[model samples]
Target chain A: MNFINSDKIRKDFPILQRQVNGKPLIYFDNGATSQKPQQVIDVINRYYQHENSNIHRGIHTLSQEATNAYEKARTTVLQFINAKHNHEVIFTSGTTGSINLVASSFGKKHIHAGDEIIISTMEHHSNIVPWQMLCEEKKAILKVIPINDKGELLIDEFKKLLSPKTKLVAVTHVSNTLGTINPVKEIIKLAKTAGAFVLIDGAQAVPHTKVNVQELDCDFYAFSAHKMFGPTGVGILYGKEAILNELPPYQGGGDMIKTVTFEKTTYNELPHKFEAGTPNIVGGLGLAAAIDYMNNIGIANIEAYEHELLSYATEKIKKIEGVRIIGEAANKASVLSFLVDGTHPSDIGMIIDKLGIAIRTGHHCTEPLMNRFDIPGTARASFAFYNTKEEIDTFILALERALKMLL
Target chain B: MNSIKETQQEIVEEFALFDEWMDKYEHIIELGKDLPLIDKNYKTDENLIKGCQSKVWLHAELKASKIIFTADSDAIITKGIVGLVIRVFSNHTPQEIIDADLFFIDQIGLQEHLSPTRSNGLLSMLKQIRMYAIAFSTKADA
Candidate 1:
């Protein structure tokens, strides 16, 4: 296994150097959004500074340069995810936008009355609500695959949910709240057997692990750049060529048009059919730079280092009395969710923030999952490769002090 | 009964002594523990203050021409904030409750210490209290 020099890695992210309240900021909010490295920030700055113009349909030098760079960013994402074609990668605003694109375009065409859509109970609101809206619109049924006490998706329950009427299956590759890595490869195979299109919400997966669209063979895969240490306004939606061709255009606008007329209009090809407006060109370039930065560190190395951190945090936090860690799935990633016995998650979050530690508390945009657990929410401390054991020590100490004040 | 300014001054004096936020939070938690109980019947959804991370219920009744406000929260710190609010507003005339400027939150530095969401909840609690005062004051006109 390749080892990551975490101390060296931490130096690259400029935001990690700053303090929050009075102390050095220990950012444990990677599941919500990762801190951008200096490389990604510079790429965005360079784009606005030198190469700032709209992509496509430009005859000027800057436009051509911007178009090339933006397309190159698409190619970067294509290669990053190992997608079969460059045009299979469409740049949406973020994961929510990407999911909505698929949900609206593909869902409008394929989903029908009496058809069923299957999603897990642990899905983020982004993944769940779009399908619910689609189901409501089309009079289709939405099915939920339940999780075990350990927060693992029950494969048997998932199998039972799969049927011929199942038109689509959308599941997160990693639960943002629980950190449970779903068996997407297996889920895709089963969904394929049922003749259903599957979309994997990879918002939490891309930063922590390697994601190959060709290997997964998922019909649609969606993720945001911010979650992976890139700019916030951009993300990639990887749809299979044939499936994307079959789906209608999500919006009607300039770039997505092949020809425009009063009565007759033709839409553009593969990825352009989905991306309608002037894209976040600078953000795309920044995302590509982020991809390059992650590649340089090596995702496998990052994953290994993050896993060690997770285990370390889990072990240490569990040793503290009155602290119950939520979501102990057999296979997990870099998120830790916990609740103190006598204190609320909000109070814990507030108390810790005063000590210059940043952690997320609440339903984590997974209200259904919170309902499933029979709790309001949990205090989530998610990690990235740049984080360290010392930061975790500070966080643990802060949490202990917070618990003392509250309890 | 203490005037709003006197109550605000007392709170400012009390919070000024605690240098560490930890000690201040401990003090708030203690205040939460000491908050007087509301009637169980009053703790209903109708009295809920919207936009709180923790569920906070505020109930107000105009008894003997004075507005008595009773509030509760599931979270200790939020309940303590409610206690601070009750200390300033409860047992005052409806018009006095409506007319008074709530300077105590600023004096106690509660708004600065709270997270954005919690501060919004605090504002919501204040809004709810003022709203009850308005309702009762109008009924007095009726």
Candidate 2:
């Protein structure tokens, strides 16, 4: 595989130099939360030191400066997702909070007792629980589309699940557990025909791939900044203006107010309506800087490089005795999940960790999917553009040793 | 019940001696064994944690002005690990649970063994435990 600006990229992340268990850290948990680059960290530091204040109000100098940076971060997100307007971009705590906002706001208004909300079998609990709670509250039905044994969504099954009663279709763009990239655009198209709004959980897709909400025609898209090499407690929820306008506010507090009275409190317009309380100011600037970093490296290049890494890693991992790669879909993102014979995933992870090759083990926030597969969980080694082939070799060797030790 | 500071100090002392990763891990599993799993009859849907790789059962017991947590899992090692957590942090008042500053979790070298999802589960367990403690303490205070 062609090496990325990997050495240059490596220098930008100080945490990469960190040693865990007497070895240099090889963080494979990017799919969960990527380590931030120096650029993002520096941006955060610069913001706090130079421009720190509550945004959207105040005649003070820091307030205006903070407001500009925060709104600029929204614009950056708009450009990143190719959303039509900055107003559609809402800052949230993270992807889960964003999804919950939609479930609470949109689901509360748009759904009725008999209406159905369709999701796939391979959804994160964040996507599932919020909707389940909403469905339970509204007496609406929750429909799950089945995935193939290879972890690809059965489009036919999804189509069958669609009906006039289907109010919303929420699906993950990529499986955080299995690396399955669902045909989200097509799903959006089908759901649209059924008069259903679509929300794409891009938490797993945004860091590795390019997403255009307008081009994809998804009504709503949610992603976490931390997973894309930015700070924690920051995320983006991009919604079409029409849908966002139709939904109610998620939380009522400081910034979300347009005006307030004893009898009635008017909420703010799009974006601000959902962002209540003091938003993460430094985190916003950090996210903008992270977007800039991605712009330089190029998402297409990263996706291509990671595709090659996954194939290469998958090939070597498959050669190991009694190793089974999970989620073998025709189309997948960079993450690879697998299990070793006669060894628990936790056990395999423990040994591999000693070799300084970090990997995620267990259900990956999709226990229902795990139950579908009839396995507890798998050991997952997800690759980002910052990863190299040598890391893959180290990982394979660790797996071999772990297998021997466990056997 | 002991003051929150005293319990935290005790927890720190219990873990302060461990130097090796594997040794620390063994201690954690043993704590999981200490997890005072609630009664099987209590294993209703409410006690069940959704999205677990295995059947994990949990409940809390109030012991001498403190909340003691008992948990069990069908998965052997996971159950053992749960026991370890219970030994370290369970049976404390809400103030104590919150104040105990489980930050030692990272220093003791336990977070590395956990998967992100499993870590999520652990956080959920901790949250539930803390929430339980808060409820109990709120009642006691009220």
Candidate 3:
């Protein structure tokens, strides 16, 4: 097992050194978005300073350089997710954009009235809303797989929901609010048997664990860059080559067409068909730099370190009086969601903010999951590789102090 | 009932004693605990303020040409802030409410809650209060 030196890794991120509210910042909002490393920032800076040009359109040297860098970033993403081919990786605005692309294009091609789409109850709004819109448009049926009190999906109930009419199964690889690491391999296999395509919302998963699309055997995998220490407004969607070829272009414009005429226009091949406009060239480069930063630290080391932090925080939080953890899944990630006995989450969040500890306090864009648990929202502290056990200790102390005033 | 300016000055003075944010928050929480909550009948969905994090229910009625505002929030800090807002704006003429400039939130160093990104809906609550005042003032004219 590779051990991560988080203290050394912390130096790479400049934001970690800053203070908030006159105290050293203890950021536990990695699930929302991770802090960018200096390397990624530098790459973004270099792109604007030197290689600023439109990709795939200009014959100038700068354009060629920019295009090479952007395409190289796609290859980085392909290797990062262990994708089969380069064209299989498509750059979208974010995870939401990626899912929307698949939903719209796939729905246009295959879905019809009475078709069923299955999604788990723990899905984030990004994963849920796109499919709901698609279903509403195509007049298809939307089925939800239920979860137990511990926030684990009930496979038996999922099995019962599957049938020949099930067209697509969209689910999160990990619960953003609950920190539940779902069994996507099992889910994909089950969906395959039911003759439905699978699209894993890897927005939360790619940052925390090793995600091999081939191993998962899902038709589509979607994730965002910002959540994984890259620049915002960039994301990747990995689809099987054959499946991507079958789907129609999501949008029509420059760079997405092979040939355009007054008569008829044919769409470009593979990933370009999905990416319709001038892409975020710098964002793609920053994402590649972020991948390089992760490689340097070793993702396994980061995963193991974060798991330790999660366990430490969990055990300490359990000792706090009047605190109930919302998600206690047997297999969990680095997120800790909890509520005090008599205090509202926003109260705790507000109090702790004065102490310079930043944790997310709200429904976390998972209102249905909150409804399932019968709570308005939970205070969530999500850890990343740069976070230390000392930070967790400070967070717990801040939380305890906040609860004292609220209670 | 004190005038809006007097009530705002009094609350600001009270908050001034607490130099640290922790003490200010403690006072706010205490105020929340002692807040005269809105009536249960007014706690329906229609009266609920659209906050992303905390739920706030507000109700107002005119009595003897004065707007009596009662508000409650699920979150204690928000409730406490709401209590302060009510102290300044409640039991005043609708015209006074419509014309009152609320600078006490900044004076008390609680301006962060009023930020658009805070999502506690303190800004929205203030807007709702003004909306009520506007409606009642127009009704009085009629």
Candidate 4:
């Protein structure tokens, strides 16, 4: 195992230096948004300091340089996902926006009345609501693939829901609330066989797993940069060439047009047709830097590390009395959602926070999933590769103390 | 632990009762149970709170000086917590409601025990109660 230099790594993040309440900061909210490394931060700073100019339009030196860097960042993202073409990826604000893009453009174009759209029970509201909105407008029927008590998707049920009427099967590649890693490749295959387009919400999946969209063979994949240790305002939507070609342009703006005459306006090419405005230039560069950092560390290694952390934390926390771990899927990302017996989750979070530990408390943006599980939402401590087992130990110890405080 | 007269006074006197005074508590917990069971029929997209961890239906009404509160949760423990909240706030005078301190929450050591969302719910209950108090206070002002 290549041991991370904790002291060295700690120095990279400015926020990690601060204490919460009185305790040293232990951030376990990586599932929500990973802390950015110094390298990523510095790259962002450097761009603003030296290379802050608009891209593709300015013939001046700064514009050309900015344009090159921006396109280069796109290249970095393309390689990060191992996509077949650079044009396949379109930058949106985040995963929510990316899913909305497909729903608004493709969903509006393709689906007619009586057509079906399928999603899993464990999807975040972002995935659920947009489709619901589209279904209401388009007069399409939205079907859900129920999850078992164990928090695993019933693939058999998903298969049952599919038929000729199924236009799109939108599923979360990794469930945000439950941490269940759905068998998306297989789900995609089943959906494809039924002649439906599949869109995978890769938001929760991208930061933790090695996601190769081509191998998965989904029609579209979406993820956010913020969750992956990049800037917050940027997201990626990767669509297959054939699917990308079929959809009409999403937003009409300056760059998105080929030539705009008052009488008739033509559209631009593949990716640019979707990117309509002054893009998140700094955020794109920062995201590219983060991808570079992750790639350097190696995705497989990061995945293995997260697997180890989740197992280790689960084992430790489970030993405490009255601590019930939620979302115990056989295949999971790096989130540990649980409840401490006889204690309110807020109490657990507050007490632990005093010890300089930060974990997410509440529905995690999936109230329906919370309802499905018959829970108020679990206190979640999600991990990333930069996080250490010692941090988990500190968190577990703090939780034990927090639980006692409630008594 | 207090008698009905005392419970009535506590309800009338404290906004805190609406927060969790009822839940330490039998009257509000029972009232939470009274929360119409939120018919399985109505638990659709309309009733949902965007960030709430569970499906919660919060119902309140003002009678004389007191505001009656009732709620239900799909989750058992949350239902129990709601019962606590409704019991405390269901009956109170506007002046008494505003003047009463919620040390009882500190007494029960519950605010610390609640999950952040539940704490928000606890606060939401308080806000709902206080809003009623303010309304009653205004009615008198009128």
Candidate 5:
């Protein structure tokens, strides 16, 4: 594992130097979106400044340069996830867009009346709603895999739900709200046995850990660039080559067509068929730059350091009276979600912000999960590698101050 | 009750005394504790504000030609926000509410202090109060 020099890492992210509310900002909202490094920001700036052109259209030099840069970004993503082929990686707006693409394209083609689609209790609304819409349209059944009080998925219940009629299983690799790192390898194997294709929402996973799609053998992997320290508008939908070839195109537009006429229009091949229009070219390049930044730091190091931070934070936060840590799965990641007894998460979050501590306070786009816990929401302090032990201490102090003010 | 501007000015002066945001939020929470809660019957879906993270029900009634606002929120900070709104806009005529410029939020530094979403909720609360004012004004004119 490469050594993470956090001092250098902090400097790479310009936002880390900034202040909020007259105090130096302590950003802990990595679950919502990670802060971009200067490298990625510079890449975006350079793209717009120098290589700005419509890709794959004109025979001009600038267009060629743009096309190369955009496709190079695709290659970087392919290697980042260890995807088998180039054409399998489809660029979409974000994780939501990627999931919607699969649900619309794959669901329209394969899913039918009485077919069952399985998801989890802990999925973000982005993962849940698209499948729900697909089920509603196709007259299919949407099944949820229940979780234990610790917020871990009950594998027994999941096994019971899977059948020959199960068309697809969509689950998150990491729970955004709970911080549970799912046993996805086993889950994927089980779904395959039931002849169900699996789509893992890697939005929460890609930043903190290494993901190899071939080893997991998930049919589709969806994730957002913004969550992984890249620009907001770009994301990846990595489908198996054969499965992608079989699915229909998501949208019809200028770029996605092979030949167009009023009478007949032929769709373009694998990746381009899905990428319908002018893509977020700068965002794509920026995402690639982010991937490069992560690779240089080494994902293994990030995972280990983040694990330490989580453990340290958990222990410190657990010591506080009346403070209940929300998720306690055996396996977890960078998220530390909690609620202070008799105090609303928002009230806690507001007070903490005064101390320049940024934590997410809401349903986190997971209302059903909040409903399951019978709470309004949680104040989530998620971490990135650049975050220090000092910052965590400050967060703990701010939280204590907040509790004193509120309760 | 004081005039709307007077009430707003009073709130500004009150908030100005607290140098720390924690103290200001403490004052807000205290004000929340002092809120004139909406009647159980009026706490229906119709009175619930949409944008808040917590459930906030606000009921406005025209009593003696003045809009009397009562509210309740599940979240303390939001309740405080509702309390602040009620203190400014309540006990005023519909025309007064409709025309009143609510600059106290900015003056008290409450606008910058809240999260973007919370700010959105505050705006929604203010809008709902103004909406009630417009509706009552239409009725008064009719």
Candidate 6:
């Protein structure tokens, strides 16, 4: 018996009611992006319809209202993540933007030639590339912490890689491809012992679990709103106030600057320093609505229900012949990634798409992880709180149908 | 041998027999199995079309002014579509290959495979085919 009433919860999402290819849409691609609930959608629609205005500059009533709403959204995020201060939350494009902001700004201030930045093998391309670019520019060394066949990070190897020269440790809290929940609190503690700043990529983590930056004591945490049933093009970057103030601004534009001269310009304070331009005001509002929706259900309940779904799906998939489940970590989220023997993932994906089952089948932006597994990619079906056991059954039937056609 | 347009028409007609998407896919999977295998040597990175989802390798050669195209994909469905593409363009002159419009894919309900977002490199493979045609045509002119 699940605590979450997913059938009642399903009504909030209109996309769930729609059909695809003459079949009911079974959205298993939540790992790619989650479908927005009507509440979040309504907030966005209402904002654009009535309160559309550029934030923080104009003295107009609409501007003030939008500005207050956007700032309130920041506070909502701060409370949601249990951050220390509202100024610590900076709005960026998405998780990629947030990570890049740290890589660029933090790298500019602290990173020097021969300084080491550590990341793991399971990092998404967004997490890997920005650091790579930073390393290349600063002549810094980027060391990768390897994972085992089960996709769990080898902590012993991580300790070996850390030294006095280590400047920062960046890793995903939950891997997008493998769905492995990394021991980030332990990772952060270890990094602190090495005198390194820790930045956790919470893009995959925040949607499924409760994240407390204060409890974890990480220097930076990044996540996207779209993955959590909010609008796209908006994300939050929570940094320690002291470090964010010390680091240079990522981008230079209107809101980020205090005053400008031809030769000299003074940057704004924390939050505004990182957020350079007129931000995604409506996206921020939608994020607040999404956070409200989550709070209404309770994150603990969402976690428990999703875990049950993951377990149920995992057990059924295990019984399938010639199917290999990747990332068999002891701790995982609601992500099921697998490959059927003697069949390509894309062929399976194409066949199942016709059945109106949307699952992601590719490298999933973690090409290096695919290389580590010595496979091209895996077909992934990630579940959310709204996904029911019956939907999982339908997905299993679809998978079996796909396998029969391919094999 | 049928002209490229005639071959496309024949493919469209054959696909028209299947009303169900599953039947169409089954036919494609069967065609994929029957596709003439590209030489293993040509499966190198240089010949590989960079698709985000799947890998496709293509090799073309000219014999007596007629281009012969041999292609392969790790995915069976992509291979099947590639076989259809090869059927239309293979044994045709470079100019004819260059001039041919690929309407058969859309007609057969396989247009999604050719979408840029699909990332199977079918669209890229089609572009590569034309590039091969242009390269060979230039060689003939020179």
TM-score-sorted candidate list, best first: 6, 3, 1, 5, 4, 2
User: Residue by residue across A341-366, what tens digits does model 6's lDDT show?
Assistant: 99999999999889999999999999
* Segments of candidate 3 deviating more than 4 angstroms: none
Clashes of 2: 14
lDDT of each: 0.89, 0.82, 0.92, 0.79, 0.91, 0.94
Give the better candidate number (4 or 5) by DockQ: 5
Q: Evaluated with DockQ, which candidate comes out highest?
A: 6
Which residue segments of model 1 deviate by more than 4 Å?
Answer: B50-52, B113-116
Q: Write the per-residue lDDT of candidate 2 for residues A1-407, one digit (tens) a residue.
A: 45477898889889888897798878887787888888888888887778778888789998998898888888988899999988999999889988999998997788899999999899999999999999999999999999889999999989999999999999999999989988898999999999999999999999999898999999989999999998999898889998899888999999899889999999998788988999988888888999999888988888999999899999998888888888999999999999877667876676667768788887888989989999889889998888888888888877786666445
Q: How many clashing pairs does model 4 include? A: 16
For model 3, report DockQ: 0.92
Instruction: Estimate the TM-score for candidate 2.
Output: 0.79
Between candidates 4 and 5, which one is better according to TM-score? Answer: 5
Q: What's the residue-level lDDT of A259 in candidate 5?
A: 99
The residue pairs found clashing in candidate 3 are: none
- Model 4, range A1-407, lDDT digits (tens) per residue? 75555567677788888787666789998878899998999999999999999987898999999999999999999888888998898989999989999999998689899999998888989999999999999999999999988789998888899999999999998887778999999999999999999999999998888888889999899999999989998999999988888899888887788898999999988889899988999989999999998887778888887898999999998898888888889999999999876555754665566578888878888877878977777899998887889999888877776555455
Worst 10 residues of 3 chain A by lDDT: A1-10
Error of 2 at A143 (Å): 0.5
What is the Cα-based TM-score of model 3? 0.99
lDDT of 4: 0.79
Listed in order, each prediction's TM-score against the native is 0.97, 0.79, 0.99, 0.82, 0.96, 0.99
All models, DockQ values? 0.67, 0.16, 0.92, 0.17, 0.67, 0.96
lDDT digits (tens) for residues B1-142 of candidate 5: 6999999999898888998777888898887777667789998998877553677788889998999999888788778877888878989999999889888888888775345556436667777889999999999999
Q: Write the per-residue lDDT of candidate 5 for residues A73-174, one digit (tens) a residue.
A: 999999999999989999999999999999999998999999999999999999999999999999999999999999999999999999999999999999
- lDDT of residue A248 for candidate 6: 90
Tell me the deviation in Å of residue A273 in model 2: 1.7
Q: What order do you get sorting by lDDT, best first? A: 6, 3, 5, 1, 2, 4
